[model samples]
Target: MATTEEIEDLIARSALGDRAAFSRLYDRTSAKLFGIILRVLKDRASAEDALQDAFMKVWRHASRYSANGASPMTWMITIARNTAIDHLRRRKETVDADDAADRLVSSTPTPEQSAVAAGEARRITACLDELEQDRGAAVRGAYLEGRSYADLAESFGVPLNTMRTWLRRSLQRLQECMAR
Candidate 1:
């Protein structure tokens, strides 16, 4: 672990385009910076990305560090912290498709939901059974099968208005049965 003065010397050397000093500085400080970024981002992959971005900023702005009057490690840590926060903000703005896919809830009904649905189906079936046989069939055809009134009338050998009447009356009866 380098002392604060030693880290500052490395930053000054790096400012002068000394690759060895920059590499040494990276070695001394990357772990602490990475730790900070990981704490902020909470995801290892995103932390690594923030770490990279933080270092890129460090390399670019190393020349300006002398006038900042902060210790070199503090400077680097500030950069890493701000970069991690920005990374988190950007991540919040755009969701990854893979993440979205992973988060997708199953469309299949839960057991309780399925049970309630089955009970409703049974009730509707019972109500239909209470109707006259032809009327029950007509109700099923018009509602369940999605047949038009004219088509149901043709199939049942009734006038269009008569089929409409049967459906309206049958629904009223079903609604009453359901209420009970």
Candidate 2:
């Protein structure tokens, strides 16, 4: 694997429209980025499409990367993730309106029930806030958004096991906080 400094340098060069640098960066990072897209999309064809869209964005937006303040890999992974999410949203928009209406009708809660749910949501948010910011965000991504551990690891630039450990510890902390 390329070191962080090497990746940063490659990104900088790519920002200057150096095709060779962009090629090198893609060779080094495509697998990890593809894994992230696949986790979000859960279909090889859709993931491949999303990955292509993400790299196209990277090619176009590399110059803005440094100004964004994210580490190079994180910035790229965010692009891939957002691309997959946008694709999913577009797919969802194509769902039959009748199905959506049925879902809305079946899922509506009474005002009293909504109040209780809102209170629970507030408690959960408070507990999440008590954790470190990254941990809290990871928890939200995994549980709320259904992101896989592999995807979270790639996005956070951590090893899979390390991501799992972070989540395990964070969940324990959240459980403790919620219990209180």
lDDT per residue for candidate 1 within 6-31, as digits (tens), equals 99998898889999998998999999
lDDT of each: 0.75, 0.77
Model 2's lDDT to the true fold? 0.77
Reference-based TM-score, model 1: 0.51
Candidate achieving the largest TM-score: 2
TM-score of each: 0.51, 0.56
lDDT tens digits by residue: candidate 2, 28-116: 99999898888778889988988888888888777776665445686787777777776765675553322111111223456676566
Per lDDT, the best of the predicted structures is 2
When summed lDDT is taken over every stretch of 10 residues in candidate 2, the lowest stretch is 97-106
Those runs of model 1 whose alpha carbons end farther than 4 Å from true positions after fitting are: 94-180
Taking all chains together, the TM-score of candidate 2 against the true structure is 0.56
